[model samples]
Target: MATRCDAIVIGSGQAGPFLAARLAAAGRHTVLIEREHLGGTCVNDGCIPTKTMVASARAAHVVRRAAEHGVTVGGPVGVDLRAVKARKDRVVAQSVDNLTQWLTNLPNLRLIRGHARFVGPREVKVGGETLAAPQVFINVGGRALHPDWPGIGEVRVLDNTSMMTLETLPEHLVVVGASYIGLEFAQMFRRFGAQVTVLEAAERAVAREDPEVSRELQSILEREGVAFHFGVRGAKVARSADGGVHLALNAAGVAREIDASHLLAAIGRRPNTHDLGLERAGIATDARGFITVDDQLRTSVEGVWALGDCNGRGAFTHTAYNDHEIMADNLLAGAQRRVSDRIPAYALFTDPPLGRIGMSEAEVRAMQKPALVGVLPMSRVGRARERGETQGFMKVLVDARSERLLGAALLGIEADEVVQTLLLAMQADLPVSLWRRSVPIHPTVSELLPTLMAQLKPLEEIPR
Candidate 1:
């Protein structure tokens, strides 16, 4: 006999908990199933833990550069990696515990700890019991891809999740993949006193961005003592008797090897949908194994939906949370919200983060719209200069004829927060003409945005 519910939510990821809460509050009996920790990847391995350690790394960096700011320390700055790990663990634990408590206490909701495999379109089986529902939501999220690259079986490796368990910093950390996750970890470990090397299959650091963006980011990482070897499609690894890792690489046909203390395979992420028995539920997945969802995030099956990383629409935590908002609004409030309504916005966490929104320069150029571009270096920003952290640039694009904001890429001190000013204007459909006229608070990084707008030129006039 199957236990019936009003709705069954799979995976307690970014979208699941809040959506389940709303469903339960509306008098539906909601069952949320999980196989592991609460709050999914962000609270466990991805955002919270990584950012906590990034904060520790940043602290170490600030202390190392204290001499530049005329702050004299009595002794050499040293990082306690164990202490850093402990602090991260504590913060993560607090978050997980709080979320777990709230979910368990949610009225009309049942928090089930088990793996859910869909037996039908609107029903799932967890452990020895079957759960049937009229509606089902899948938010299973994703995990780091452990590729069958050469010699992968020979050496111990760390992905994003296992890397968090590190209590000691690596002497030399070789990170595979030069995208956001890989670069962030490379910089973080480098700041924690690891000699870091990054290997990318592409010619550039972040291949998806504008070539200039990639170049500047690579330069920043290089200046921070992180080595890069790009255009490497394959690598062979082995562990020595002394516990050191040896990586043999071929970058554009030139072969090289790196003897390092650790290896991190930050290649990519695969959706957690593999084990969910989507075929049994008659659900459709993309070639990459991501759940296929429409604009409203509905799956192929009736009354089924997928959200967050598993849906392939977006990967960031913010996107997943927004997915929850969209799902809730559409289901509960009768609004016709959509996944397409979202503008792409995310920040890369480096020493100085890169905040990006909307189309890239390449995308804008391909669109062939008459666009105006504005560029500014961090050196010119008052706050960046005053903080002695001027090391990047800001670039924004606008549709020339309409004067509407198009896109922005900010890479510098407080760039993550600074880019929001442009994000809001773009989302609100505010024109750059009016945006530039407003007086912003003086001496801040964002105030320089208006100054940036004043320097707009034809997009083609700007060199990437």
Candidate 2:
């Protein structure tokens, strides 16, 4: 007999698993099919493994600067690359086990591992098994996009998938692209004793962010001995006579050569929409291979939905989790949840760790708003002095007319936790003055908030 279900989820990543669990808990027969691991990229490759490795890299960085805090170990600090890889692997394995157990324990959920292809409307074939359902959700995430370049196959190049498993550190590494992945690996590898050179096609690193934040990041990375070639385009790689590789790049009108022991490509990720039989299911995809969905995450076809990286809205795991929740409520309880008012946040795990939420200075200008900007250098904060970490700044952008907090960027200690407070303020449309009046905990990095609020003035008044 052909297995029947009320809903079938095509991938078991952050969005797929959460949605599957939600549908099953609502008494719908939900089956989740995956071509790979249960937790998808977040647990398997993207978030869990990278963050775990980043944690070790951060610890290594802390040990090197430990004397400032008056804490000293007996001997010189050492980093064991093999041990770091072992620990990252352990964390990934534990996450997979937990996800597997959760799905198995769900009463109305069944997990299947195989490539699923749509055979017809509301029907799919997973290898030899055929399944039919009233509603089908495609949560298929993405993989690292490898563009065709000269010597692409001849030279060893690592993407996010293979980079974390590296046991030995290269003496010199040439990283392509200055996006999130490239910036992250570049910083981590440099801290791990690799002479890192980042090649960015864009004029600025993290061109999507505020110009001030991008400039600050470049300055910070340069201070840490990472070389960068900004405004460079068209990179070609060739194998050197020896065991190394030579990278030739065209920057504007000039050509430059870069030699390194290892090459990493972190350009970007493309949606995995091809060969999914979407054409057969009458699903529509845009030019970028992203599925087109409405505000409710519903495709043109009724009872069919798409979420996460597949939709290309925001690829963060937390964003996908929220997408899953919204989709579930829209499907089951008829709740109308627009993706607006979303405080989608990101944290770049660098030396001091930069965290951002909501709009930026550039975005506010683009919207033609009278932007009031406040910048509070961490050096002035009492907690920064106490913690001996005063290398970065906290900046806040506000709508001068509305007096509401627009966005915030923090580049200092505990930025990841600090962004959450800003997230709440932005989500609730809280006034910037509220932060100034409310007394923050004494001798904490968070005290920068009140200090920054007090410095609020016109964007023009902010000194560069």
lDDT of each: 0.91, 0.86
Worst 10 residues of 2 by lDDT: 145-154
Q: Any runs in candidate 2 off by more than 4 Å, and if so which? A: 71-76, 252-254, 460-464
- Each candidate structure's TM-score, on Cα atoms with residue i matched to residue i, is 0.98, 0.96
Listing every candidate in turn, what is its Cα RMSD in Å to the true structure after a full C-alpha superposition? Answer: 1.1, 1.8
Please provide, for model 1 over 352-451, each residue's C-alpha lDDT reduced to its tens digit, 9 standing for 90 to 100: 9999999898999999989999988999988888999999999998899998888999999999998998899888999887756989888899888888
* Candidate 2 residue lDDT tens string, 198-297: 9887889999987777888898888878999987767778888888889787876688998899888898998888979998888889998999998778
Best TM-score among the predictions, by candidate number: 1
Clashing pairs in 2: none
Score residue 176 of candidate 1 by CA lDDT.
Answer: 88
Local lDDT at 274 for model 2: 96
* Pairs that collide, model 1: none
